[model samples]
Target chain A: MSTATLNVTTVKADFPLLGREVNGHPIVYLDSGATSQKPRQVLDALDRYYEEINANIHRGAYLIAEKATTAVEDSRAALAGFVGASAAEEIVFTKNATESINLVAHSWGRTNLSEGDVILLTTLEHHANIVPWQQLAAERGVVIRWIPLDDDGRLDLTDLDQLLDGVRLVAVSAASNVLGTLPPVRRIADAAHAVGALCLVDASQWVPHYPTNVADWDCDFMVFTGHKMCGPTGIGLLWGRRHLLDAMPPFMGGGSMIQNVTFEGFTPADVPTRFEAGTQPIAEIVGLRAAVDYLNAIGMEAIRQHELDLTAYAMRTLTERFGDDLAIHGPHDLENRGGTLSLAYRGIHPHDLSQVLDQHGICVRAGHHCAKPLMKVLGVNATARASLYLYNDESDVDALADGLAAAGDFFAF
Target chain B: MAGLEDLYREVILDHYRSPRNRGELETPPAIMAEGFNPLCGDEIQVYLLVEDGVIAEIRIGGQGCSISQSSASMMSAAVLGRTPDGAREVLRSFKEMMSIHEHGLDGEPISTDDQPGASGLGDLEALRGVVKFPVRIKCATLGWNTLDQVLDQTGT
Candidate 1:
């Protein structure tokens, strides 16, 4: 094994799901861009919480209630520190990145944006970022504008100033789900800030692969999901400036988010709690903290380097083997991309391509990947994507290569 | 354990490479049905030339996985020139066989002849292996679903 492989394997021991077999062959999981596999440490943390201190946080004066409250607050603090935020109050627990984006769209978007005002978003954003704004625009008569993408799937920064003019809010993904291109986010944020527009970053694909500093990016709001980062599902986070969150109205009204309830009037709680109205996913939060710690232990910089190297290897080997028959989507250069590779065989459907890969125990995602507008822009109905994460290696790429060849031959007479 | 080779049988590859009845039908008096797999974005549009309750001609167009394409290719060939009732019976049999579980027709024969007495699938029997791979079953049934939709339009 190479040094990267050795490092990944050492990390694999912590995740039990990596050792399983699918279709009677060792599972070569290449679908991490969809959802990552969880580690034993994360699972153990969840189990420990349920077993030891299962109680409604801040509800009762009992010892367990205090312990639960401490655990939740401690996790919030850790998460705040992980993202280099000012305080735990800046982080609000959400269901997923989808909910976070929706919360912002429904709360700030409905209240602030108006007719003739434009919401600027990148052409390559996930549906979560695009659809919410589109819905809000349709409802409120706000005009929606797009920052066009280049041939390499990178953002076209040439018109950044023009696009930001009169834009109430700018939303974009940190990384494209299909092309894997990391946008010039800091520059985009700076441009948006210059125009007095709030920039929201959908870091669902980026936070798992790289270290994220909201303060460094100076983004007004950011959203990410836990499952994509090897944490439990049904849990995500929305990080926003304390002032912006405080000013926005409550997204959902419920018991915990209210300071005092009366027949005449009800007062809202503070920032994060005011947004998080329902009983949160307590276990998922605990598990996400463990996932954060796991990433910290391995170090994000080293992991990012490992993934970059793997992506380079995959691009080189795949391009050399299949040539033009394998049409790779997104950026041409590895440095301009993330770990996801969306490609299509010349005349074969992605469903067939994925089936052949499944036979080799290689898990890959196939289809539009929830970016239909981008798919129409790319001029294809669907494409097969093989995504890499911390646990993937050269062998997995080899499996995908072999599977593509088999699909090519099978589809050909 | 069924291998990839088993999943991609020679017959399936043959049907996929040189699909049968792969064309558009005449527009007038033609009923069309489309089937889509949201998971893989596989799609099929089936057109039938029906004449006084009989399937006078059948044609299909769309893009999909090899199994779905091949299945549509074979389906257009299978149900052509058969009465709506006869075609539904044959489709029912094909669906039953594709289920893979025991349905009490193991010893019985499926005929492929176009004559009034011929009543079973001969070349399509190769799809029996698809039962081992459950996900591919939908691929094999896209054309059949279209057939059902066409039959539904026939009011049979």
Candidate 2:
């Protein structure tokens, strides 16, 4: 990408929601790991789409309907290209990453996994990824194993060889939402493949924060939510190998996913469509495509670098200011982590801290972050989390530090 | 930065840091109640020592946000020696106050002189400020919810 086109400040300004104020102060939205703010381009694309062409794709023959169909399929190819998937057929649309994981668990897992088969996951997985497998295992008598984490929250990869002995599928997060640790996905993928096991990468936290190529990672399936990547909420992508997607049974039965239905039986549509049942999230998919384009324009490399720098800045600011009173969970090294820090204030609870931060117009998450097993491993009920995205700069870090200090004083007094 | 004074009233902070009657009761037939805030994963466990329809003692243990912990502390301090009926009345008044931001407890002993003022839930009054901060409302009421469960279990 050309530096002439890369106007970082202008790009920041394009995000209209980021301009809003909270609690009589300019909102310092550091919770992008949860959901990112959309840019004008993405929002406008949705507006232009609805105004010009609004119709169900594939079946419609009218001009506007054809345009809508083209737009949807074009976005699909764009998204597939973005992930470096072998074909557009590999990309299936779902409501969010959770639905994507559930689709796989219900469809592929139900068919393949049986009694005595082992499914391996990590403690750092979101409830969405963990629960589906747990529910499946319970029904099929399959065993679930978790990869433990070290003190700094990096997954303990030392026991991978032993753990993979009977593992049928390895479902792991590319990055932890709570801890910010970016696991070695490629290595994990290689190990899983060696054992003839399918690998599913939950890249919900990693996709927006870093540049990812599914082909390079070589995972059997990859899932990420659009909302987390500065797109609309209802759309997410599940990229699977075409061969694997073709082999798996359909997840849900409804419109668009069927070729034809007869009294005798029904034949399912091809790969991608077979997994996506019902009316797709049309506007959201369009917005997601715009989001992907926006990021591509910015160059994900620059974004990743900027975030790494911000993470280092945040970690330094937090530790130096609070000392031992603050404990930052996750990998101590910034290189192995995403731009997230879940910290516990020694005396004050995360809820109190978040309340105080909210008053300051500093938005941060305070809780288990939907990773309760990780919380249990960390030995804390909850932690105050400040997650960063592209819009976050050094000033946000300063505000967070100031807020944490204020929380300490208020509670200590 | 907005000072914590806006949210953490001095009384509430005091209760949180040094909670009164924050522990467990003897294991024999204690009325146990648990409350959880699924949003934040905050949890509280409360045990009541009930004898002859009066709270002989009240003990609470568990981990949660400050509002819940302090509220639990204040709740324990308020209802320890009261009759189950009195405690239930106070609970009703407190719930009313939290939901509406004020209480007009009609014709109860709570309205009498020498009793605390409108927000004057006594130590429970420390949480009156919680109504303003909506998210903390769950934290403040977690203990009271547990207390409600305990009340239900004992059929009082």
Candidate 3:
């Protein structure tokens, strides 16, 4: 393994769930791509929020309300810094990444898109990224275009110019949840800008494992979730360019989002507040801030480097153990991929494989992973995916290998 | 480990390796129904040729995991020549076996009788172990559920 600056063993010790046993074996969690295990820091932050400062934010005159409001805004500022946004006002909090994407689709898409306009997307998107556009296209009579994938699972951008001809917006993923392929978002964003179209990135899988600078990416909008970054669920972020957010209409209309109360007409508040409708998830935001602090303490570069080393080690180990019996999907080069590994093995079904692996206390995902279009392109109905994160180590990879060997032996003719 | 062995029995593997009734039936007299387990991307299409209230022929198609495919294979073998009401009874019996009911074999003794139509489930008892694995219970029942839908649509 490569020399990581952060100590993974110490990091793993912070997560209480990792210490538990499943069935009779120690639990080896390799499913962080679905949702990461939370550290004690985040859990404690959430607990502290409920215990010490619990109140409705933004409207109350009580001291606790002021503290809650400050804490929530502080979290927004920290998350903005995490993704390199210029100001906290640019970060709009929503229920989750899925809701963030839907907010943009309802607010910006309905306003900007017209009949015959095109929304270009990539095949690597999750269902959250695909369904909203499909719904919008069906509603507005807009045409949707796709950027295809190469044989190795990276985006085939050779036909990108042709696809961008009438495109009004280009929405794509920064990383593939199934294939682990990291597309060049900067280039795609630049291409979209050259053609006078906007660019939106689904960074749900990217920000957790790597350092994300939305300004450096030069995209019009970006989104990510808190749960995938070792925080609590029910809180996610949508970071958009200041001008674009100011120009769009409010996503939800409610008490906190309005500037005036009248039956005749009402003016919406400023960008971020206009997007947040009801009472916010205050405890989740506090947990997210703590998660950001935890990740920052370890350093994003160190996490990325450590995952790269683990990915290489995993690929080498699995290939040595299974050889041609295993078919791994994604870019062959480690530099072009993340730590997610989706595998098809020995004609053993992914569900059966997952069941067998469960006997050994190994947690892996089995199925389309909400990327059915990519699964169709890969020519498989489903794949077993084992994704890695900061706390995962070489021993986890060994356990996975042992589990797969057992599955092979059990299913052998 | 014994749970795993019970789940992937030799008979289940045999059917998965060499599935029976795995093609299409001519459509003039055949009714088709498709089932999908969206959670796992397992898709199965069941085609039935019914004549005079009896299933004349049955075919299973599509792709999925061993449990789903093998279950479909075994289902076609069990229901091919039975009448629509008989097929419905068989479906109910199979679902009862897969469900968490108190009257299930969990509290009762295991039986070794292989007599046809003696135990109400016949070879379908091979899939009894699926109930233990809650997540995979859907995979094991995709075909039978589709067959139920098709038979319902065909007015039985």
DockQ of each: 0.53, 0.51, 0.68
For candidate 1, give the lDDT of residue A28: 88
Ranking by lDDT: 3, 2, 1
Instruction: Residues B21-118, candidate 1: write the lDDT tens digits.
Output: 88787666788888877666667888888887678888889887778888888887888888989899889988877763323235333233223223
Model 3: DockQ score:
0.68
Q: Arrange candidates by TM-score, descending.
A: 3, 2, 1
**If you assessed candidate 2 against the hidden native complex, which CAPRI class would it receive?**
medium
* Per-candidate count of clashing residue pairs (backbone under 3 Å): 2, 0, 0
The DockQ of predicted model 2 stands at 0.51
Report clash pairs, candidate 3: none
Best by TM-score: 3
Of the two candidates 1 and 2, the one with more favorable TM-score, higher being better, is 2
* Model 2 agreement with the true structure over B107-152: per-residue lDDT tens digits: 2233333434664576666566566666677888889988988888
lDDT of each: 0.85, 0.85, 0.91
Q: Candidate 1's error at A155, in angstroms?
A: 2.4
Interface RMSD of each: 1.8, 3.1, 1.8
Worst lDDT window (10 residues) for model 2 chain B? B104-113
lDDT of 3 by residue, A115-232 (tens): 9999999999999999999999999998999999998999999989999999989999999999999999999999999999999999999999998999899999999999999999
lDDT of 1 by residue, A137-234 (tens): 88989999998888878888998898888998999899988889889889999999899898999999999998789989999999999999989999
TM-score of 1: 0.89
